[model samples]
Target: MPMAADDIETLIRTAIPDAQITITDLAGDGDHYAAHVVAESFRGLPRVRQHQAVYAALGGRMGGVLHALQLTTAVPKE
Candidate 1:
């Protein structure tokens, strides 16, 4: 089954409690999504590492239930 947007947000928030997350259903199928995440914790991390953090939050559901995720990460503007 495809994952729910709320579930995705919850999982990410669980991993990064301070994250500001915006999830959009890209294809309207519930499988493809775009996530824009901003967090103070992302500061100084490389882009790949930031993406890894969000993927880790998903707990191995990336290629299975979650499918494609178009992710963008940014450190909060100070």
Candidate 2:
């Protein structure tokens, strides 16, 4: 099954409550998405780790229910 944009945002917010997230449907299909997430929790974490954290929030839905995701993660500006 494809994942909804709101569903994606909800999952991320659940894991990182303080997250400022922007989710976009890349193909007009629920299967493809792009998310830009910013949170204080990502501070000091490496870029790869930041992306990992977002993936973890999805609970292994990446390649299954949810197909492609172009993700960008960042810490809030100080």
Candidate 3:
């Protein structure tokens, strides 16, 4: 089954309530997506750690049902 964009957004929002997220369907399939996320929670985190947090929000579905996720995480601009 393919993952929904809204669902992905919701998951991230649930994990980081103040996040601003943009989810794009990379392959025109729900399994492949690119997410650009800005959140207060990512504020001092390393790039890898920030990415990890986003992936963890998906409940380990990265290589399973979710497939590919090109993720970019940033702290909210001052």
Q: Which lDDT tens digits does candidate 3 get at residues 1-78?
A: 999999999998898888899999999978999999998888888999989888889998889889999899999879
- TM-score to native of every candidate shown: 0.97, 0.96, 0.94
**Alpha carbon deviation, residue 12, candidate 2 (Å):** 0.5
lDDT of 2 by residue, 3-53 (tens): 899999999999999999999999998999999999999998999999999
Angstrom error at residue 62, model 1: 0.5
Candidate 3 vs. true structure, TM-score: 0.94
Q: Which ranking of candidates, highest TM-score first?
A: 1, 2, 3
**Candidate 1: residue pairs that collide:** none
> What's the lDDT for candidate 1?
0.97
Q: What is the Cα-based lDDT of residue 69 in candidate 2?
A: 97
lDDT of 1 by residue, 1-78 (tens): 999999999999999999999999999999999999999999999999999999999999999999999999999988
Each candidate's lDDT (Cα)? 0.97, 0.95, 0.91
Top lDDT prediction, candidate number? 1
For model 2, the superposed segments whose C-alpha errors exceed 4 Å read: none
- The per-candidate count of clashes, in order, stands at 0, 0, 0
lDDT of 1 at 44: 98
| Best candidate (score: TM-score) | 1
